[model samples]
Target: MMQLTTGERQLGAIVLIALAILGIAMAAAGRTDVLGIHGAMVLLYSLALLFLLFSSAFGPEPSPARLTRYYDDPIKVGVGLTLFWAIFGMFIGVWAAAQLAWPILNFDTSWASFGRIRPAHTSGVIFGFGGNALITTSFHVVQRTSRARLADQFSPWFVLFGFNLFCLIAVSGYFLGVTQSKEYAEAEWYADIWLVIVWVTYFVLYVRTLALRKEPHIYVANWYYMAFIIVVAILHIVNNLAVPLSFAHAKSYTIWAGVQDSMVQWWYGHNAVAFFLTAGFLAMLYYYLPKRAERPIFSYRLSILSFWGITFFYMWAGSHHLHYTALPHWVQNLGMTFSVMLLVPSWASAGNALLTLNGAWHKVRDDATLRFIMMAAFFYGLSTFEGSFLAIRPVNSLSHYTDWTVGHVHAGALGWVAMITFGSLYTLVPAIWKRERMYSAALVEVHFWLALVGTLIYVFAMWNSGIIQGLMWRTYSPDNTLVYSFLDTLLAMYPYYIARAFGGLLFLIGAIVAAYNIWMTVRAPSAAQLPLDEDLPASDRPLDGAAPTPAE
Candidate 1:
């Protein structure tokens, strides 16, 4: 367990007390105003304060002798929170989908509108689910690869709680109709500023840990994570450069305007995918895939090469989203060119993952976790390829406003991002908790199927609907007039929307089961624990005198 210093404990207690007081104030206001969103935030803040207070009073027992070197508490908390946010995010996602299919589900309330909750859902999953996963896994991977504990114990908790605090504020603001009108960057100036503070602390802590490494060389995964953290911070600050109307108001305006703003927004948007979603998860893939398969990476050289390649190419590729817009044609072409080039590095990483499993094919069949990682790799290749293709002007012409882009996004989001995360969590949760195995390997299998089938259903439905919509929009009548009205396309998409909602429901169910499995594993008797030797595969056992490598 983490041993907090006096200052750290005092800081934590003070923060909790502040949150509790804020919650009490919010609850009082909510009761008088009947403000649903404020009531929700009050509940969240109160429960969080209670949980922190309880944990501080009665912390987990100390790490056993065998685990003396590692710091696992932050990783454990992160994994649990990742599960919670994922389920919460996807639930909102499914509801949002249902509301689109049947608008009545919006309940005609401003707070419950699809517009309000859409950002909530996106932020919940992206920042809440994916962000926590990256932070937790980075801590785990960085420590293991460097052969060092995190540099500062309190910092990880600070990052975890501070980042989540920003997420909470962002989501609550969305429900309260406060935003900066940016797509993924919708969090208002105050939340954005808070995130900046939290993120800088995160970067300092990460570098500090790396500086303390006992290993001779830093691992490949850390490079990817470093890029993720650094680039995201840069992108976030630059793109969210907004001037608030007043300190008392949530409204703000971006520094850039018109075509420049459009360019900057997509520049930030696409790279959010590149950095926040792709690069960070790639870090997870690099560490977990080899460990789960009981093999070394196929090529450290390839990993390094691809890392540089992705970082360089992905930044220039965001302009593709601005194709055929008011932006200069030359800029669009530049984005298209770089996006296509990104395929090489993207595929290199995917190939490296698959090739690492050269002799572990049987493990993929037997180990559900390995299957998740392997499939994630496959889908990573597919998603990147599809991304490059869609970036082409001609392709974007058909896909930009259609559901095809939506399908493509999910192909990566669900197939690659969520899959790899689920895989890593399964591998991580057990090790962090010092469990012999998951409470139910069978349930992991169930999750794999549900996720796979759900993704297939979701993507294919969107693909079909998107294509139909696009073709209909482009079609001309015998006299060179439009063949179908916009409403016609909207009506055509209903069935597919219904289908997509069902798919989301399936995925949500799988996540719930996975959460339950994790909870049960954590609760399982210590008597069920196996020896360390029994937990590792024979092939994974370190040979005598072998120096510790990244996965080892």
Candidate 2:
């Protein structure tokens, strides 16, 4: 049997004992109507406990050396989970899109209904997939740049597993008709509390590791990650302020009502995009792009400038989501102005990314991973530009309540977020796994084309559909009367909706191919592991407790 650490043994014993008690309670509760959705949750938790025990009893033995350890195990697990959730989330997204196109795909079941699964799809992709990518990459990048092992071994594991636990609860609750009704903040109060606990631990662990860094200055990537952590905590707690109806029922009501609630929700929503999608991924981009290109960043000062600009500008931009509604006119204008101004920093970073590749365009041609990052940078610039345009009051009037917003989002989500993420993973996976390269670079080329083609199809379809809908809605029939009924708009959307679904399916396929390639890479017979000291340039890998080295 593997020797478990004192913490591991205690944790395992607690879980084992807790599961035994909960299993009995849940078995009784199953016979009662009051247990509700928790009965199912109880069974799941019990099963999880069983798996925990099996692993605790029989998993690999603990290593003896602490300082010499690279802390790659949890990161490796996080990478695998990232791929799994990406497939699961994108698959749900495809299904939800099809329901829009065909309507009959809902099939009259609550779980299958578009209303229920739409949240599932969003949560799966955004929180499940994207969130995991951020956490895992942060773990990997922090150690590499800081050149310190994580502060506590077990705490990192707890952060990863605990966050995933919250994801599971949020996803399951959505399917079970348990929600708080806020867009992107739908997980009920209990899940919200659970997440707060996990997030605080994550924040602490991150700070602790940074404190132990051997280098004098904290790396730029850590700055973005730190901002993401701090700002997200503020947004989550403030926006999710609610009173639960009861502990037994997964239901809650927001503390704020009316316009105040609208303000709060968008504050959380827009920043979720800013911090979650943009900042975290931008941090990942900063680390991965230059590393892959084997060049120094184009301008470190520009990175510093862009980071501050995005951090300051995005906080006020959420109110743009509530424009032309009950939100005050000045607040609406404030959001529009800030959002439009955001284009400067946004393009600055994008241009910075492209310029880093000044001498590496040839590598971009041969290396699909570089191609993914390059395309991601281009799309990041394009999407941020589109976002600024849409934030203008008049443009918002046309794009608001139309599929145009959806197209814009997919452009960022698929184009910027997913594309860069795939690029990073391709760069990181083989290196961490001690492989010369991916199982097949050929498959990577196939995936890049599939993802690019899919994103183009999806974005153009929504763009065309949104403009048509906007034009139809505003068209006057000679006397300032509405020319088209709402059904006419719905009718007009079928072809575009079909195209969107097809595009999503193609993206999903590309993700699966990537996942399979990663699996094969991990399982392939090891070509001797690369020495940690030699894996990166000496400037990039500072020794713990040593002074930093100058970059070439």
Candidate 3:
């Protein structure tokens, strides 16, 4: 069993004392209920820290190791967590989708209300599912490309465990009605504080690992992931600046109010999509595509261009969400212009991904995992183009507060983010578990089609419904009175909602099949393990069977 070192023990004791003080503070402030939720979160973080500290002190001494030893375990743990959470997160997504079709499907429970569950679904997928995937893939890419292990084993575990614990607290608190009510920044003060510590740990670990890298060339994927981690840390802190009523409590009031709050929230919200979702996933694409295809990236120059372009342009596009609002006209115009420019970089990345499959098209057909990734690239292109169009003032006027925005988000989330995550897991599981292959490739193909078709049906139906509702709402009946009653617009949405539910059901079925496949793979007899240092050519691998070049 692991045991804590003197330093580690001191850290644990400090954390406990901090929690106790925070609890007392909240109770004194008459916010005990809020403090209880946050206290639970604090306990979880403390537990994770304790595990790390003990492991560092007393776990079996690591072998005389190269850089790979440090990162490999962390990568495996992170990947395992990603796979575990994918099913749960996607399940929540299907549930939320069903609620749109039948509001009563939420069971009229406060915990399962549309408002609460929607955040739950989003947080589950985005932070839980997506976050795990990003960290796992980023760790893998960083280690392999840099030829270095992570800087420290315990630190990685701390970041992973603590972040997930924070996610748990944030999601659970939402059901309990503890929120700052910021769009993507909804977690109250306690979760925010824990996250700050976890994020700082992550930043430190990454920087330390980079410092020890063997390669002079920092891989493109690491660049994107670094940008994501850095920018998100800043964004989170800025947008979530709130004064807690007490130290232990989850409840807090945003320092900003009214339109200023709205501006800050959306700015953080949209960039969360940009940096967290787009940038991080792009990192995955950069590494996985080349690795899976067993080919050089199509154009390194294009990648550099896209990276800078996206970084510059995406920051300004958030204001487009607030077009025609109280925001200054120049800010809105800047958002519109930058959003249009965003198409260039977005497509550049997509083009790079597709072109990387230049000689690897056969693998895409045979490998269900590769197909999912390829299709994700396709959807990324489609969604970005749609996003650019939606950001236009005229388009925003029509689509705002309607199902169109919903459709757009799902197109990106389900089609792009979830698909890439699935692809990454499919690639990761067999490799990590030392399995020769998946439980059933045919089942994966079925899952792919189900998700693809389901996403299409869901997004397209909502698009049609949203456009119709928007048009009807804007139409005046001879005089200045509204043309359609709110109920009439809702009535118009029923059929589309039903279609969306059907699509969501299909997607859920796909996720269930995937979960079953993973479970069987875990249970099945293990294959002979390969030597860690064995340097097999890409052509020797199942996924990347193309001939290896001298450069490799």
Tell me which residue pairs clash in candidate 1.
none
Candidate 3 CA-lDDT value = 0.80
lDDT (10s digit) by residue, model 2, range 12-119 = 557546745754564454443323455456557656755765666655657777457667877898998899899999999999999999889988888888988999
Q: Report the error of model 1 at residue 194, Å.
A: 0.4
Please give the CA lDDT of all the candidate structures: 0.87, 0.87, 0.80
Q: Give lDDT tens digits, candidate 1, residues 1-552.
A: 246655566667776666666656545654543233444564586567557655765565443452457777888888888999999999999999899899999899999899999999999999999999999999999999999888876788879887888888888888888878888999988678879988999999999999999998999999999999999999999999998765544578999989999999999999999999999999999999989998999999999999999999999998999898999999999999999999999999999999999999999999889999999999999999999999999989988899999899999999999999999999998788876678788889999999999999999999999999999999998999999999999999999999999999999999999999899878664443533356677766544333211221
Comparing 2 and 3 on lDDT, the stronger one: 2
Candidate 3 residue-wise lDDT, 1-552, digit = tens = 122235545555576557556545545554458566456455555655556555565455444544335346666667667766767776777788778778888897888888887888778778988998898878777877888877765577668877887788788888887777778777887678779999999999888888889999998998999999999998999899999866545567889888888888888998999999999999888888787778889999999999999998998888888988899999899989999999999999999999999899999887778899899999999999999999999989999999999999989988998898788777777766667667777778899999899899989998999999999889888888998999999999999988987887787788778877766665454435434245777544333221111111
**TM-score comparison, 1 vs 3, better candidate:** 1
lDDT of 3 at 492: 93
Error of 2 at 55 (Å): 3.6
Q: Which ten residues in a row have the lowest lDDT in candidate 3?
A: 543-552
Evaluated at residue 212, the lDDT of candidate 1 is 90
User: How should the candidates be ordered by TM-score, best one leading?
Assistant: 2, 1, 3
Which runs in model 2 stand beyond 4 Å of their true positions?
Answer: 1-4, 12-36, 39-43, 46-50, 58-61, 529-552
